[model samples]
Target: MARGSDRKRPDFYSRKAKASGRAARSVYKLEEMDQRWRILAKGQRVLDLGCSPGSWLQYAAEKIGPQGQAIGYDLKPVNATLPAHAEARIGDVYELDIEALGTFDVILSDMAPNTTGDRKTDAWRSAGLAENAMLIAQQSLKPGGHFIAKILEGGDVPELIKKLRQNYHKATQTRPKATRKESTEIFLVGLGKRH
Candidate 1:
């Protein structure tokens, strides 16, 4: 039998990431997605959800560069300092006033629900978070923009996909290589937002 602590052990990505100065290993996920699908571009505006450790924001700032804007919001204070063009704020997604942040060319969400270890309950909660992210994207995403949000593979994802299909030119699910083999998480990529 496998020890519970063993499951918590960091893998290769974590080790390399620790040495690479990334605040979180999740930077690889966004990097891979952007490389594969061109999700980010220089001079575009981006908003990141649940960006506490700020690794995603770090990578985003690099890709967006000085000409672009990267705005991150989370319930806790961001752990890393952002670039001049990037800003991190303490805020809750459910209560966030997105109008103040303005519209963006892209929105990325890696929000994870507080898991209880019950797969069904965890899936439900994750689905709820994805739903809220979609609503936020609708409110803040520019026409013909893009959205990428992490979500559990099961639960109410079909409904979410259906909703995205109606609003976006393309909706697809992708899992980056950086994701753990056992992880049920996947990214829902919504391309060409049609407001």
Candidate 2:
């Protein structure tokens, strides 16, 4: 019989957070996606959802530079201060009007639903968040734009993937090196918006 003491531990995020000077190691996931997909560019407009702690915003601000613009939103206030070029709004993403923010070259969502320890329930909630973010992306993203968002391990992900495929030139799922091995979380990256 296996004992609880025998369970393996994963610390990829801790090590990455230390090395990268980020609030959380999840920033590397965006970095990896950007590297693989070339989603970010100089002078482009970017939006970040659930951007608390501002790690993704920090990375985006650095990548987009002064000529570019990066806007972030979250229900809770971000504890970290952002760069001069980056702006953050404290609000719910689902309620926000995407048109008011203008079109973006890239949209990134790292939103995670509050986990209840029930796998199925958690998955559904996470998927809902992803769905909302996708709708916002569709409304505000420029043609040929990019989107990256987090999703749980289960719940109608195939359908979501199919829809993404229809809207983007390519859509892929990636588990970044920065994510803990024990976590069921994954990222979906959509590139080259179709319309």
Candidate 3:
């Protein structure tokens, strides 16, 4: 059998991210989705949940430009040096201080549970994280705001999408081209939150 490290060698996206000075390969996932959907607009306020390593924050900052704001929160501190318009803080999503953070025009969550090699258990945990991100979006997103969250594919995902559709003007899911072929991760895009 091939060695584990060899099996996981850097691919196109990984090399591209390195060349472009991005913090992680996951940045391409957000880039593809944002390009497709126009999720980030200049001068919009954005919140990035579970924004550790800060690649998403970096992308958001660039898209939003100098006039916009991008605030990120995660359990771990972001060590990356982001742009002036973007800032990341260490905090648990479950105990996020929404009032202090104020509302946002866009919310993004790329949070995922630590995998245990069991599909069902991991999916359940990912669903829970997505649900929590949805709740935060409902509360903090401005009327007609947008939300993007990552969730593993499994039984619980449909119900989560149902809730999103009920609350947003449009709800859909997509797997970005950057996603690994072996990965079950997909993104839920919720646009135009209702008043």
Candidate 4:
């Protein structure tokens, strides 16, 4: 068997982003999804939750083009180097005032609560964030819009998936090729918002 140092670690996202001159590796995740689902369109209004490094914001801004708008929110201040069309806010998602920002055509969330090493606790925390993102999407997304969020593999995921299916015309899970194989995290894409 190869030693840990000798084994090649996969980082497809970083490699691709570096080749394309993007700020963060996470951009590839959005790119792949957009290519497959065509969830984004020019001039659409987008909201990005937990958008720290602002990779998703960058991807959305480019896809939405000049006429579109992208807003990002995170618990901490985002770096000042984001694209001109993208805006960032430092705030908690649960306390966010969606009405203040107005409705959006797409709501994307990459929120993952801090891991505590305890599997049960981590799962619960992650599920809470997923649920919160869903709530925000329900209030902010326009009819036939899109909602995307990060969720852990265990705990209440089944229930959450059911709930998402109820509110969206189609709900699917995705493990982007950019994500590490060892990670249990997966993204849930809810398309064609029902409410």
Candidate 5:
């Protein structure tokens, strides 16, 4: 028998993603969210948080059509092939000035923390990242804008949902089919921000 470390992990999603020319399987999660929420439309400016790999950027640019624009910021380098209308930068979300970047019609975040296998610690950390993203949304989202983000479900998720509901007309959680069966990650979509 192959040793545990020597055994190759089954990678259906990554293989399928590569075959479809997507940079990552995470693209399908964003696709499901967009399809359900209509977050991307012509002429809508979109912001992507932690947008490394740039698959979300590419998908957003296509959905926004030629008239719209997609902007992404990440702590690491973004290396995916993005459309002409999409732009990306290497920067931290906490430091980026939303006023300088201009308000966006929609914001999407797919950020994940570096896991250490401690479930509780990771969940709280994920919640913190989501909260930080919310802070950015308050500054960067135009009136009636939408916000979507991925978060590990646990710890302060209820509090996070409460905060989102207080800020937007509609707030809900969704787990996309593309997500692995064992994953605790889920998405929160906040629609129609109130001024």
Candidate 6:
């Protein structure tokens, strides 16, 4: 038997995901953001970064429909079966060539640093990943596209937001209800990417 700390507890979202045959509970986060912000649309090409377990890609595939394509990349392999419109590859974000992959209508990143237990270190690392995602979005997103990236609250976040504001028509941040209570992660949404 597992100890109290070692035991896994399924929350309401997790149970819903299992019932709906979704990859993971993280799908709901993207759902809420998309619903509230009108991010994903049918026939839009999407690029998903750090898409391990592929919950976001699954959600994107449904939103974008068969006419659209959702491509995902992550350090770990995704074992789930993806929709015909979606595909995932194992790769590091830092090494990816955004230009070679071509442009996208939407770019999403759920990357987080491997936690070190120290909040500051973790947040800083998350900031770095978020920055990289922003760079990819800037380079690869078509005009009037959208970008969403997850970043832990850290000192560097304001600087990152400043850059987002300069590059996108509208830049905002949100903490989705699906996020864990203790998690410091917040998502930065950049709507209407400027050329």
Q: Which candidate comes out best when scored by TM-score?
A: 6
lDDT of 1 at 176: 89
**Tens digit per residue, CA lDDT, model 1, 1-195:** 011211356988878778999887788888999998898989999999988788899999999889999999887777776899998898879999878889999999988877778878877887887889999999999999999988887778788889999989999889889888877888899999988
| Ten contiguous residues minimizing lDDT sum, candidate 6 | 1-10
Candidate with the larger TM-score of 1 and 3: 3
lDDT of 2 by residue, 111-190 (tens): 88777878898889889989999999889999999999888889668888898999999998888876665567788889
Better of 2 and 3 by TM-score: 3
Write candidate 3's Cα lDDT for 29-92 as tens digits: 9999998888999999999988878889999999999999999988888888898889999888
Candidate 5: C-alpha RMSD after superposition: 4.3
lDDT of each: 0.85, 0.83, 0.87, 0.81, 0.82, 0.87
TM-score comparison, 2 vs 6, better candidate: 6
lDDT per residue (tens digit) for residues 107-188 in model 5:
9988887776888988887788888889889888988999998888885878888999999999999988877776788888
**Backbone steric clashes in candidate 3, count:** 0
92 in model 1: Cα distance from truth in Å?
A: 0.7
List all candidate RMSDs to the true structure. 3.2, 4.7, 3.4, 4.5, 4.3, 3.3
Q: Which of the predicted structures, 4 or 6, would earn the higher TM-score when compared with the native? A: 6
Model 2, TM vs. native = 0.91
For model 3, the stretches where C-alpha displacement exceeds 4 angstroms are 1-8
Error of 6 at 2 (Å): 21
Off by over 4 Å in 4: 1-10
TM-score of each: 0.93, 0.91, 0.94, 0.90, 0.91, 0.94
lDDT by residue for model 4 (150-178), tens: 87788587888898899999998898887
Over 34-60, each residue of candidate 6 has an lDDT whose tens digit, in order, gives 999999999999999989887899999
What is the RMSD of candidate 6? Answer: 3.3
TM-score for candidate 6, please give it: 0.94
